[model samples]
Target: MSTYEIALDSKAREVEWNNAKCDKYDYMISVFCGLSAGIIDAFFVGTPGKGRLGQWTDKTADNMVQKIANMLWTGDKRSSVDGRPKNAPDTLEKAISYLEQSFPVNYDARYGKDLINGNAISGMSPLNHHLLSLAHSPDIIGLLFSIIDQFTGKATFINNGKLIRLVPVKDARNNKVMYMQGTNFESKVFCGVCNWLGHLISDLCGSSSTRKVGKTGRGAGLPIPFYNLFLLMDLGKFDSNSFADIAVKIFEEGYDLRHGAAMAIPVLIEELSIKVIWALKQHCYAKKEWKDCIPSAKHADLRMMLLIGNATLCLVDGIDAAIRTGIKGGNPITFILHLNLVAWARLVMLVFRELKIRYGSIVDQAVGKYLAQIGLNDAYSLKQYYERMNAIDQKLDSVLRDFTFKVEDDYKVFIQSLNYTLNSSLRTPEQGRDVSVAIAKKEGVKSDRIFRSQEELRYWLGEKK
Candidate 1:
């Protein structure tokens, strides 16, 4: 066995049969992996569920903000999700049907094709798609809601030099918009926009990202309120204008990366690691031949060790790159400290991955029984969601499965028709894995799978097992 495989076996040998301990490891890994994907999903490519809400699903924050800023410069009203068409934002069909007569003069030519082709961006990575699968899953919506609820809070803000606490005020449409006490911005500013009756507003014109939290008011040393990103969502459409709405809110809130590297690095690394692990996990489960290959507990442990070990190595390399970049910029010592934290965290995850591989089934059974006995269920909901989504993706794959590029010169018409935006960038196996790992670190996306090299083709064909 390889050195890493031996280490994994050793770690697996240290597993204990404690339900609580196993649950802790399970939660840790899932949260670290899932939340990383969730945040990226929430930010970059708002899932269909969040997109239906007109949230930040258009593009990356930087992309959206820059595009909108350019549009604003050129007086482009046709810059919204659906452009200047008379379509409601509630539905995708209407959004597309109402595309404006023309895009902005300076708009990227690709944007027009992307918008019309319904492929504004490249397909999401496997990890991102996995999180999105959960996002769109009816079963896990409540779980996601609960996770968001943990970070939900009423934000305290300063409006027109007056410190005020926000409270929700329902408009005639029954949409809840937060209001500030002793303020006339609702009647004065917001009323002019919609002319609704008895509408109120907060003092700061609207929800401020630079707001305070529960008893401890905003101050010089207080940590930035990351939760406001969620709270602002509750503030309704008035709070959302562009994808950058959340990004700007996060920036304006407090404790930027430069200011709070100590606290920030871990949060960044944790999220980064989550994306890495999630992308790796998808490949592990994607092996159809390996589905029943995990027969014995030992076999399962070895498989998991391979999965976790690869992911950990990828994450270590990513962080190591960041560390090197930081060092060259004269921040070597500070980066060393950050690297130490990541190293420790990496060790914990490896140990947990091994133990979970051994005792995970036992923990699952215990948790299942406990959940059933208490009426709190859906222990396998995430798995079910992934399977359903993967099935759909597989059906789409079937349509193209027979079209091998080795004889591509014969079918011209078929190729032209298949030029849709969704799968424009097909991958060879070697390129695919490298792209998967690289993009997962750089963009938090997993792109599509590619199998070109001999070993990879064998793996993809299920001949390697």
Candidate 2:
């Protein structure tokens, strides 16, 4: 002791802070962090154990039902041992109280007010920036859903009782309630599976010309209307029929979903029902917009990253209608039909990508040379390039103008090709029955595996020509 006059290390300050935080969440650490030291447990340690930790690692199919039940009903309770420290949530009752305190009953009253008042909790990691933990702990599912229910209320501005609106959580910019972004697990599962099946069909039938070939540009994520789709699903309005049928109905209706993209012309065609055609048209239009808004041909790599955000505005009528119709009443065939519609959209995107690539290559080969001749460099900023172009020789100007005309013509070709494909695919018995019958009759004899008989093929094609 006399020889040991060692000074405290500078790193002790960080250690002390970590120790304090660990002490605060000791119970949660014990329940979730396995046998790691308390300091190591403050942040997620991704260990193997029971209770909070078990759900993350245990993937046995048999345990799934029990896991779900636990998430729905179980409460966190810590064990009392000679060596372990006792925290406040020492029993199931206390655990419930602890959870409630941590998550809160009203989102708007607590976190919402803070966000609206410009005092939202800061220091969020970009990747996992969720305010509340919705992972691992099954109790969190119950807690979050319960919070949602508490926040849900009648709209004061319109359709009071008829609409069970979620209370405004953040300050409305133009007086509107902000809804949650991202599709819930239910919708994701449904849509993801449907998407997979659609892809499978594309692979087998070559329905889609290319696989995931587009940049998916800015504003390419699910539309604001799609967010409401999730909200409507959360409301538990859709009927108890098959999930497939519900998905189909939603796609067919198109729900008047918002469309966003750069350059688009509304496609009109007489084929299937007007609603189905409209959905196809919107899909094309939105993709067109996405293609146009994305960075230009020179900066194609920049298009790889997507910036996703949800609309703060919520339409009461949309939510109300979803609840009313979705609660019950949807055709089972709708999902299959919806998949076909999505298939068509996928083809359109692939075709668009091909056109973009082809045109971009042409520009790079021909116009790029002309631009370099006129002192244009790929390294130059768009503004710089534009200014230089304005000062180019009249002959060079004509060449640039001709290049632009070619690009526009290419764009027109892109739109027309997609429109033609859509018309051909969506063509109903009434629109192209004669052609379909001839094609089917010729192909039917070749595929006894698909068509049991010529008669079956006729019914399948909806014609007997």
Candidate 3:
């Protein structure tokens, strides 16, 4: 048994024995936390179009877009008469326009017709094309596709439950050219990446045209991160639209990244509230150490509480959606719009986490029972045994090393004595014969079987024969 194995076993045992107990009070607290979060979600994040939080997120996104645009702005810096830099974007709309002209792509298809290629992309339009195009997404998938499209002069889009690629055709009359402009491949990739980011920022708060119409309506914005992936799920039928179509419709109606941010607020509140409350209860009521009071998921009680809390939150959200949509004559779009996808996602994650923890516990318990039957259940005893074994192993290594040195020293001494005897007896044959006979007796050999003369002895010892 190695020290590493012993330590690992000790840690496993500690984890198994230290499982936190959740009482009825814990469950009640979790439910209360969830209810509180649900109320916030209902009041603040109602729907994409009219939710207070959604509006706030939209403004925040607009601010972010302006900031990013200003950073990417590289036009002439000459000052204008108004003291503002010439050709510089001052507002969100101007910033968006600046980006549009800076990073023009060939894949701006609208209404089933490619803007550059003149190819067909069914179910695509200015309103929902961003949702259908993978490159328009504000995620890694989008970044990769954006770079690829720039290099290939083609666009990738998901339409009618299939992937579509459209290549641009040359127009000799206009002769308007667009390509990733850089000195090298690396520079070109960098330019592509920048172009992708700049374009997404321009579309973050909606197109410049929509912004020009003022704040009376929700403008078309980029879809939520990875939300475009929903297009692959071409399952289910709601009214006349498939699930994929419904997803696109949802995005077109203001359920974009800004609204997704709004939806995250309640989920964050629920998570933080539970953790803070759990920590307070542990430290104040339970009198636990500060380190132990941390509400980490590693603690069994914390995991269970989180699972219960999120589940309750989802329940509340579902009921609220049901009631609100029912009042609107049970419109499918209304119901879908009112639904809190973030809460449901959190609940699902908690459920899977709880199941995994329970399964692991079961396996650990079975193994522990078998170990206990063999009287090897004590971690301390096992650790001590391994420690002792390691000590003995180190001592044995030292002893063997010393013994080897001693044997080598004794052999050298024996060779020196033999050489001395051979050199001294070289003058007398009889003396050498007597020495040989004596040496033969010591080696358990008969005198007659051994070398007799000095020369013969010298030959036997590897001297010139």
In order, what lDDT does every prediction score? 0.34, 0.30, 0.77
By TM-score, rank the candidates, best first.
3, 1, 2
- Candidate that beats the other on TM-score, 2 or 3, i.e. the better one: 3
**Candidate 1: worst 10 consecutive residues by lDDT?**
197-206
Clashing pairs in 1: 125-446, 125-447, 159-203, 159-204, 429-450, 429-451, 429-452
**Which consecutive 10 residues in model 3 have the weakest lDDT in total?**
168-177
Where does model 3 exceed 4 Å of error? 1-18, 74-87, 115-119, 169-177, 213-215, 360-465
Quote the positional error of residue 110 for candidate 3 in Å.
3.2
Give the C-alpha miss distance for residue 351 in model 1, angstroms.
4.1
Candidate closest to the true structure, highest lDDT: 3
For candidate 3, what is the TM-score?
Answer: 0.69
Clashes of each: 7, 7, 0
Top of the candidates by TM-score: 3
User: What's every prediction's RMSD, in angstroms?
Assistant: 26.9, 31.9, 25.6
Residue-level lDDT tens digits of model 2 in 202-231: 111111111123522111111111222222
Pairs that clash in candidate 2: 237-326, 237-327, 238-326, 248-334, 261-289, 261-290, 262-289
